[model samples]
Target: MAYFLSSHITSTLWKLKPLALKTTCVGSVLAVNQRKYSSKDDAGSEYLHRSIVPTMHYQKSLPRLPVPKLEDTIRRYLAAQRPLLDDENYSNTVKLAHDFQNGIGKQLHEELVAQDKMNKHTSYISAPWFDMYLSARESVVLNFNPFMSFNPDPKPEYNDQLIRATNIVCSAVRFMKTLRAGLLEPEVFHLNPAKSNTDSFKKFIRWVPSSVSWFGAYMVNAYPLDMSQYFRLFNSTRIPKPKTDELCTHQKGNHLLVMKRGNMYVFDVVDRDGNLVKPTEILSHLKYILADPTPAPVCPVGVLTSENRDVWAGLREKLLEAGNREAVQIVDSALFCLCLDEEEMRDHIHISHNMLHGDGCNRWYDKSFSLILSKDGQAAINFEHSWGDGVAVLRFQNEVFKDTTERPLVGPTTPPAPIDSASAVQRLEFKLSPDLEHGIAKAKENFQAAVSKLTIHAMEFKRGGKEQLKKKKLSPDAIAQLAFQMGFLRQYGKTVATYESCSTAAFKHGRTETIRPATTYTQRCAQAFVQQLGQHSVEQLQGMLDACSKYHGQLTKEAAMGQGFDRHLFAMRYLSNSKGMEMPNLYQDPAYTAINHNILSTSTLTSPAVSLGGFAPVVPDGFGVGYGVHDDWIGCNVSSYPTRNVHEFLQCVQKSLEDIFTVIDGKPIKSS
Candidate 1:
């Protein structure tokens, strides 16, 4: 069965998913191993005393969402998100999702689809964190639209071997469709809702059963939405009849399809609409996405313009020249673009239907791309990140240069530079909180309670869980179980809290966030991912279960509700993890959008860098997401670690469903 998270958890996970890596990277490379300290009475006082000091990296870019309208849009948008799972929309869903894999993914997949395809340099690295935003209201649409209602979540794709199958692949696909519908364009890029009884699209995608021991699964999907309905949603998100002429209104801004950043997209409704009052800016957004921009600055494939080449080669040597002293902090990197945009000739790429976002997506976008064009002297550029990694950026720049007189995208063409705010500039007094102190104390109490006197005696220092998993062909669900129990066994404290939070700065536009009762939410995920191990070895399962049960039970209830461990109350914590505080805040004092425990670019990975190519989104938990180097393998791959702790709350999730086969077949080979 596919276990959906609790309401609070679902929302929290969704929001946290986006900022997972970025937020955690704050205030100097956030140390993953940093110990949680309990706060004294001073925690709240410190927060209260900390006034709104401003910063520059991101100004009060957060304007109030037209309150009354925002509320209405949120309600309507959420209601439209649900799809009937029993119908054939299922096949259509797969067909749509598959487009991502086949079209955009094909570029990366063809190269890294098989292990042998990877050359020596096929390693994945963590790039720095950046904040991109969107503001919505409904004069752009009328009622609330689902995509803009809640903040999108961070999604991670692991290259680990598939172990268990808690939810059927169909469920996973459906969940993906649901997430896609909730985040981006639904109808075109997604499965057509149950319509005719004979849509063959439903028969295309198949679900994997819980049999495999080691499997590899990767999905990069983009769903579509009805253009008119979407436009209605868009209009609602904007301020109606501005008392004064405000907003980045286009005087010279002729409507052209444009994607702001490399990954997120934009479509001009005027161009496609044929007639328009105010040109609509379609932010073809991605929640957990992978894209490739085929037309501008990076497409027409392979060839790079002189200026673009200079930019790439120039950065390679860290040119001492004045004008370009490293826009992105990383000392080593490359940029290229994928030829995925087909908006001009056809609305969609050949892969699947989920190729565009928002309105005008299915009708025209499915056949053509949201092409960037110019009427005035200025030209517009657009593309998807699914083509390749950050390197693809330079490739796109080169394409844009081809049209410019410079022939090389030098002067005005340089896109925004990358920034790593591990060190936000707010000079402030730092103090610990009572909750922090209590959390630390509770963790210890639970640990002590969970580890029965016999655990120490019976536990072997290292019987080799990794080795065992390999041979047993453990599933992802199985790994979650092992991690839950094993992590506890190896942990210094009893209660292992899943660190979950988001970068408040990332989505200044939307006020809704998902994580509530952080403690219970995590505990349940721990149980769900862990307890399912019951299907495996009863002895190991019971032993681990008893320990967690006892730890949670004795750790609270009878224990005086004092000195930390409490079964009832839990608190939400926040930390100013943004480093952009050095600059001045225009509205408030040098204020900054504080990023709390976000996943900044890290120097780590959950597993050893494999040769398989393709991008992986930021995952929920396993390896702690924080700022570090790409070369550093901290929490590199989820498949490498056991997932027990997370599974406890999530209901045992296996690594790769394919891995389950080895276990059931009786001759399980070691994972290593």
Candidate 2:
């Protein structure tokens, strides 16, 4: 249960002598050279040290419960809108549908193209949220591998197993399930009204999240445990029984598909000796994993850092040039962080992925930064958030990018940036907060009840409302695109807007709260998009649209979503889970190690430039990162269209708006 050493400054006593002994409250510590401390020059110092601290057994847990499963919450709140396989005229949404497929497909190719830059971070990129949620969920589900053996002994001083978190910004994660599965045929998550698989789709919705959670649990639960040995999973346990492993939709009559109803192209990667493998290899095996079902799920794990900013400069130069021969001019917008490594295994480090996550690490740091180099000599940034909220995340990313680049948008004169230190004043620490643990516990019960209700009807369940949404149709900008592309489209059109879907079912409140922001943003965007439809001259309209976006962003009807900020505070207190939620945000903390693994990037953004990370997606190429983003829905549907490609279409539509604007005297049109 231990994840950290006490916050009481262990430095005061250590200042008197250089002691090599390890101290741990919670978490792990690699090996220590006890012999070095046994024969210290000053016996008096050793005795003093022993008197102040006693060697002890670990008997506590990390603070803070993991992010909760929102699937049941999603289903219950979304009851009004049907999520069926045939919910939409998939036969009709060709442009958007094909684009969605193409967007992911292109990313597949890019995943290969930029394979070197990717590592463990790729899979994290695949399902950032889901993956994090899974790590935490599985930690408990499988008892957190308490029996699993690690090589390093009692180096809790190196790694107290605490989890540090960073915010995820622009990403291509929604289709990761399908992408990982690497389906040969097109598989849609939204209902397909053209097909009668409504029952199947509904069943999928009901089953997928749980299955995903279990798969992670299976990984943890089923793994081999040799207390004196190392980590190995699946080899100890087989897949569950027919009922246990039965998936909702595989189209193939057999229920053997592991990632049923979703794409399962990516495979799990491991070392030849059957250990968790590196991210670089996982990415290499992606092609084969997509083709073969026998392989395990792949994870790409590697870390990058600003510590070796020089090395990154070289690699970035090479990567930027890796593209077509056209000089690959890139408008780069990068977000970075200063990872403070307090303790762990490698250089005293831990966690997953590239600088995107895993890069913020253990041993590779000086108070200012870490330059942990991989075999390839790339330094990984330590301390990037793997656990901060979107806004908090972006705020930090913006700071990192701004500081690293020497140019900040809030203007250099903005208040000195605050660090997300363990000592950071709690963002929401209010003195008079009431005890809502009971309500939160009740919410969890209700959420579980909702999930069970649907799971019971697993084979026959059907989500609702697709037909109506389909009838209303979606606007061009509703589609997602690489943000920069959306920016470019604005040069041609008078208005350029992005769409962000609110979590339609996060809190107990149904879609109403979710609906409010979507409506406000949608209306404002409509006004802007219509006015610019095919416009040529934009100096004036552009100014107005910018003004309107700023105005619209002020709408806070969707503010209630923040109610569950401390999702497991009550659960932890009641169950006596005893993990401190405010443990330092670091990579070596095992706390950071267990995170949502199958998360596909989705977010709630009101502003186009408002990156989930704040600084916006860096346009490596002239277009956005993945599909030409017309808009970004990630996976939320407060807007009818939700793919990056839809935004691509909107960007093009912006051009048409420019042309139309010339003819319409710069006035946006009213809807017919």
Candidate 1 lDDT over 1-672, as tens digits, reads 000000000011121112111111111001111111122212120011111111111112211111122222222212111111213533443343344334532333233223222322211110011011112111111011000000001111110001001011111122222222332111121112232111232222112221210010111121111111111111111111212111122122212222222222222223332222120111111100113322232111011010122232332233223222332111111111111223322211111111112212111111011222211111121222111111111111221222122111122222222322112111111122443334334433432332121000001112233344434433221233234333442332223222212112122222111111123322433343333433445344334334443333221211111112110111100001122223211111111111121111121111111110111112222332111112211111111113223222212112321222233344332432
TM-scores for the candidates: 0.22, 0.23
The residue-level lDDT of candidate 2 at 611 comes to: 18
- Which structure among the candidates has the greatest lDDT? 2
Candidate 2's TM-score = 0.23
Per-residue lDDT of 1-672 in model 2, one digit per residue for the tens? Answer: 100110000011112121111111111111110111122223221011111111110001101111223332222222211211123422323233234234432333233324424432221122333223223311111111101111111222211111111111001011111112321111111112323123333234323342132222122221100010000000111111111111011121100101111122112222233233332232223222223333221210011112222332333334334441221110010011112222232421121122222212122111111222222212232221112112212222222322222221121122323332222211111111122223223323433332222100001001212232123232112222222222333443312222222221111111111111122333334444554444523554445434333332322211222212112211222122223333221222222122111011122222212111111111111111111111221221110112233244434434434433332244544433
Instruction: Go through the candidates in order and give each one's C-alpha lDDT.
Output: 0.20, 0.21
Q: Model 1 segments beyond 4 Å from truth?
A: 1-672
